[model samples]
Target chain A: MNQNYSTVAQRSSSVLATNKVLRNTYLLLSLTLLFSGLTAGLSMFLNMPPMTYLISVISGMVIAMFVLPRFANSTAGIGIVFLITGLLGFGLGPMLTMYASLPNGGNIITLSLGGTGVIFMGLSAYALATRKDFSFLGGFLMVGFLLVLIAALANIFLQIPAMSLAISSVVILIMSGFILYDTSRIIHGGETNYVLATIGLYMTIFNIFISLLQILGIMGNDD
Target chain B: MDWMQIASALALGMFLIILFPAALQMMKNSPKAAPSDWKAVIVPMIIIVLFIMLLIKLV
Candidate 1:
């Protein structure tokens, strides 16, 4: 399959790269996921309002953009990652609560979670094994990413269900592209810091789950 | 428009504005993909689409 990756001399730098960062990224990612889930459960138990979701997510985004990068190389970065994840997960509680009120909501949530797991694992494995550079995805994903952001922002006021469904479907594909790009970056040394890398991968998984949940939930409602 | 909706639209707009330049720079600096490279990504993406469709049907 990946001939260059198979042989010793021709092996892509990815296979030869220090896999310690990769291993650590996964470890930290799992820990953050558990922390986030715990916080989400706590938020739901407290009956957090929908606004809390909006507020916390906005706060988390601000922190991620302005603060996390400065400290991403330090141990403090780990704390920041947990803080951001917990905040976002806390935000997620109300959304999940809303979904849970629907018929067959549990199935929708479970399947979205499971589907996220399968897609992340499958894409990550492929990226790792193939040893192909996905750097070219940079420009394409950027255009797609920006266009989708504009569409999503417009849809907020439009409140069109079909448009929302289309957005969610496109989001699934975009996040998948990100997974490949991010994973390949890690392998090829384009991404070295485990903290930053974990955050990238974590966000992709989170988005995939959210988009999947929305898509499946909408489909169920149509039944 | 409601205050909340206006606030949301502003927030999303600001997020895009903040991120755009850096995203564009990164895109410009990265290497271009070969025609052959597209082959690898398209195959899995198709499989993913089909798998998602199946999940929708099964559910």
Candidate 2:
């Protein structure tokens, strides 16, 4: 009986720890987004070379993403969190330059944020209410992602604006499915590592936001 | 290559990396245990190689 009690205590403590990590990840992500936005805004205001800056930042991100996860053991995870967020900020540079400079830039940014919020709320609510295991979604999402990737690359050469819109829509859907699967994983005790969970969630949100921004730019009236 | 192009490529690379390992592990029926041993690393490595080749062609 005593052993069982101790085991329960241990399990509870772990759950608490996971929750703490989740909270911290979210706090950090918010701050990182703010920092990235400021950096992009400042660069655009200064008329800096956005492309070169973005490339250098993204190159570092690619390296970190590959190397950091393998060593996400202690402060390593925190360091990775900052690195990935910084890269994402850099990724936003070009778009920020374009959108912020335009007369209707604010609208595009607003629409993108709204779309992201809607996706997060809708998918998160569904995951919480249904209680159905969404583990199967992982596979379907990957297949969908591959399809989008091929389509996106094809459009680059084909120069089809319509195809780009279609791909963006599909990418948004796939990322939403990922959000569901990832959130379910955490709530169901499937993902014990908070840093890994944050990484997964961050990717989903990042993809969704990017797609949303693209779609809004293409579809919105900029008068 | 353009920044937009590079960004897209990077995103794809990250997706492939996460997908390969997680999918292989999911294929196994073991609930708590990850399905792949070191033996499974070869498959993802091959996929990454193919992905890099494709990315090179695109760029």
Of candidate 1 chain B, the 10-residue stretch with the lowest lDDT total is B1-10
Q: What share of the true interface contacts does each candidate keep?
A: 0.56, 0.03
Q: Whole-model Cα lDDT per candidate?
A: 0.87, 0.65
TM-score of chain B of 2: 0.42
TM-score of chain B of each: 0.82, 0.42
Q: Model 2 chain A, poorest ten-residue lDDT window?
A: A52-61
| lDDT tens digits by residue: candidate 1, A124-154 | 9999889788988877887788888899899
Best by DockQ: 1
**Tens digits of lDDT, candidate 1, B4-55:** 6776788889889987997799778878788888898899999989988977
Candidate 1: which stretches are off by over 4 Å?
Answer: A1-17
Across A1-223, the per-residue lDDT of candidate 2 in tens digits comes to 9999999999998778757765665676666567656665665666666564556455645655677678677777767776776666665777767766666668777767665766676666666676556665565566667767667756755778889878877786677777777877876678767667777777777777777777667666435
